[model samples]
Target: MHEISVAAALMRRVLAEKEARKLERISQIVLQIGPMSGIMPDALQFAYDSLREGTQLEGTELVIHSAELTTCCRHCLHLFDSRLMHTRCPRCGSEELQIMGGDEFFIQYLVTEKV
Candidate 1:
């Protein structure tokens, strides 16, 4: 699964941050994952758990926050957010839409132990 690679990359960034900040221990990692990001949270968590074994992040908690899908109607220029997928704009019923958000995969923040 590609989640392994994703997890590996995330781990690399986390390690870099830890080293850069000279952190003693990382307690948690908060992630913002969009519904349309094509990332399975369970699979990503499993991959992260497997990859962190025997590493500095072994016990680090992985927290995932599901982001809402936001879209704008091309015809009406109306913006709306939803957890479900929509083919048309709710305001104008136009098929033409611009996706404003809900296709993201990024680290939001990290919780670390203090010295």
Candidate 2:
């Protein structure tokens, strides 16, 4: 699954920082996930839980900060919130639109220990 790769990539970064800080263990990992990120937090958490065992972050918690999905209308020059991929604009009921935010899946921050 792609979640495996995603976890691996994030772990690599966490591990490097842990090493630099002389951390004996990791505490938690915080992620900022937008609504339209298309990545399942539950699936990612499960994957991370399985893959993290026996590693420096074996007991570390994976916390996700959920983000909302929003879009902007190009025709009416209006902004609105959306949970769907592409729907008519809420302001002017126009189909023409553009994405302003969301669609993000990134690591925001991490908490670790310094041994």
Candidate 3:
């Protein structure tokens, strides 16, 4: 699945960083996936399992920091949170909006052995 590939890519980067820092193993991985990132955590977890096999982070915990769609109203200059792709501003009910956040998926932090 797509999540599998994403997990694989993530693990690759983490492994590279771990080696550079002389870390022996990973205890946990914290990830942030925005609302619009379109990546499911369940699928990602499954993928992580496969990708982590035989790696230093084989049994590491995966923690996700969820993000929601945050938009700023163009007309009222109000900031609001949403779970929609496109919707009227909640504060002023305006259609004119500028997306301020969401659309992100990346590793935030890693906890690992010092060496």
Candidate 4:
């Protein structure tokens, strides 16, 4: 699955960070995922857990934060949560919308121990 590749990339970044900073251990990785990011948290977690074995990242915690899908209605200038794409605005009944959030996937922060 693509999650495996994603996890691998994440691990590579973490390892690089550890090496660069001379960290003794990494305690946690905080990831922010949007509803439309097309990445499953469970699969990513499983892939990360599997790939971290026998590595410096072993026993590291993966914390996932899910972002809500939000949009702004052009007609009414009202901002609201949009659970689905192409959703009509509740206040103005307009299909014209500007996506404000929920299409992001990134590492928010990492907790590490210094040697």
lDDT of each: 0.92, 0.83, 0.84, 0.88
**Of 3 and 4, which scores higher on TM-score?**
4
Error of 2 at 69 (Å): 2.1
Which candidate has the highest lDDT of all?
1
Question: Tens-digit lDDT track for model 1 on 1-115?
Answer: 6899999999999999999999999999999999899898899999999999999999899999988888888999999998777899988899998888788899999999886
TM-score of 1: 0.83
**Model 4 residue pairs with clashes:** none
User: What tens digits encode model 3's per-residue C-alpha lDDT throughout 16-105?
Assistant: 898798877789999998877889877898889777888778878888888888889999999878777667877788999898778779
Q: Which ten residues in a row have the lowest lDDT in candidate 1?
A: 82-91
Q: Which stretches of candidate 2 lie over 4 Å from their true place?
A: 36-38, 113-115
RMSD of 3: 2.1
Error of 1 at 98 (Å): 1.6
lDDT of 3: 0.84
Which pairs of residues have clashing backbones in candidate 3?
Answer: none
Give the local distance difference test score of model 2. Answer: 0.83
Give the clash count for model 3.
0
Query: What is the per-residue lDDT of model 4 for residues 1-115, given as tens digits with 9 covering 90 to 100?
Result: 6999999999999889888988888899999999889998889999999998998788798999988888999999998875577678888889998898787899999998666
* Candidates in order: C-alpha RMSD to true structure: 1.9, 2.0, 2.1, 1.9
Q: Is candidate 2 or candidate 4 better by lDDT?
A: 4
